[model samples]
Target: MNNKKIMIYGAYGYTGELIAREAVARGLRPILAGRNSKKLQPLAEELGLPAMAVELGASETLERTLRDMDVVIHCAGPFSTTAEPMMRACIEAGTHYQDITGEMEVYRSAHAMHKEARDAGVVLCPGTGFDVIPTDCLAAALHKAIPTATHLTLGFDSDSGLSPGTAKTSIESLGVGGAIRRQGKIEIVGHGELTRTIDFGRGDKFAVAIPWGDVATAYYSTEIPNIEVYIPMSPRRAKKMQRMNRFRWLLGKPWVQNWLKGKVDQKVRGPSEEKRSEQKTWVWGEIRNDRRGERRIGRVVTANGYDVTVHGSLAVAEFLLDYGGDGGYFTPSKLCGYELVEKLPGSGSIKVGID
Candidate 1:
């Protein structure tokens, strides 16, 4: 049994609560934390673990709170705003940091802090969960099979609907349109600017390119100079997204963001336990070196996105507590082996074919 003090911040949030409960069920007791003591305390009490209320904005207090903790599983988001400050504080406190963030910007920011985290001996990794873990693993596996790969593509088809946090992130992403890695540089494009037919092991489906974390992460992991990430979409919905690109400017308005956030609070309860049980997510990856006439394709089917997030987040957090590492920024595949998927309880299987 590990004795390290593990803390899950935003412990009462939908995804956070599930992770906290799962931690307990696995015979681990983690300190729960968030901005509200009232919300954090009851959950802590029920789970028989310690609790603390510390605002992420409170730098000094946040540093102090993290100073003694061995690992912190940051389950809060719209991470674009929250991840930076927490990452800074963890580096200051010498605490290892892990967060379930899908935001490519967050991953880039963490990677940029590699030197600081390394000097401070803090292991900083983002997208430990559904955000990029499964896909990142697949990318690494494809790269392994086709070592000279120059172009990598990843896509997913999930029936796992959004939680408030994910919905908000999607709204933010929509406003910014799409992103891809071109010749090792990250580039932004219009919403739904790229689309292709992809066989994600089920059959050919129209997939539209989106700004997924792997556009940044897979390139970093495999040094594949060109990369794009996509999600299966109905042709009608794909066209709708393309149409929405015209008004992308409106989505960034403070008033518009506020209204959308309010609606999420009122309507998005995330998936219930039974609902999560029934849902599944599929991740697909393809890598090729056109110059070498080599190509590889792979896919993985996993539990509902949210449930997989909880399990992946826990697995990485526990791994950090037990395995000492030279601190630095890491993708899931970079830190944990690509076979990390094999360790995920209900994450199903990864299948690959080469040509």
Candidate 2:
């Protein structure tokens, strides 16, 4: 049993509620927190867990609220707006912080605070969910299988619908070009700059490169010098993404971005529980050393992305609580070795081999 308390910030959010339920089922007592007491209080009551209503900008109050918590699972959206303040509060409170962010910007922010986190004896880990869990694990596994790996290509295909938070993040990044790591350096390219046909055991599906979180975390996880992350995109959407570069300025404009955000808000709020249960996610990863003329490929068939996110995030919080580790920045694979994938619901070892 953990003596320290766990806090789930943004506990009223969709993913947060899922994580909170999972934590409860696992016999964990998590404090649900958000900006709304009405929403938070009910959830806390329903789950028989503590609840706190605190605004992020209220630094002093927020820090005080966080002070007693051993770890915080931040589930807020876009992360760009929420991560920094929450992270600062966690640091000041000397609390470990984890989040389900897939944004490269957030990963960089958490990474930049590694030294500070270590000094404060606080673990600052982000991307504990669908963003990089399976991919990071795959990257680590491939690197283990081929220690000399220098290049990585990861492709993900999911039938799950996007959460409102995820949709918001995607909207904010619509104008940004794709990103990749080249020779240990970060580089940006047009959306369709790189495309590949990935065979994830089902059939060939064309994938377009995108600025995925793995482009940031996989580098640290596997030390691979070159990496490209892809998600399957319909040809129409692929063309649209490519055209975004030409109208980058337009898309980046506040009015346009806000209008797009409004449209997303009007859409449905992610998939239903039934859909989440019925759908699965397919992930493909490859590691290669062109110099050695060797390649290894791995595929993961896991529960839908959102389901994995909830399980992945809670599992991370539990692990950190059970076995306190040296405080520092870490990715999923970095915090819990590649085998963490096997422990995740609906995820097991894949048959990886040379191709």
The TM-scores, one per candidate, come to 0.97, 0.96
Judged by whole-model lDDT over C-alpha atoms, candidate 1 comes out at 0.89
| Error at 246, model 2, angstroms | 1.4
- Model-by-model lDDT, in order? 0.89, 0.87
Clashes of each: 0, 0
Tens-digit lDDT track of model 1 for 1-355: 3668898998999999999999999999899998899989888888899999999999999999999898999988879989999999999999999998888889999999999999998999999989889999999999989998889999988887888888888878767889999999989898877999998767899999989899888888899999999888889998898898898899878789888888999998887899888888888988889998888889898887898789999999889988677998999999999988767877767788962
**Which residue pairs in candidate 2 collide?**
none
lDDT by residue for model 2 (1-355), tens: 4688999999888899989998999888998999889989888888999888999989999999998998899997769889989998999999889999889999998999999898898898898899889898888888888898889998888878888888878877767777999999989898777887888656888888988889899998888899999877677878877877898777878899889889887874867788888988888899999999899999888888898899999888888787566887898988988888778888867668865
Error of model 2, residue 325, in angstroms? 2.4
Residue pairs with clashing backbones, model 1: none
RMSD of each candidate relative to the true structure: 1.2, 1.4
Consecutive 10-residue window with the lowest summed lDDT within model 1: 346-355
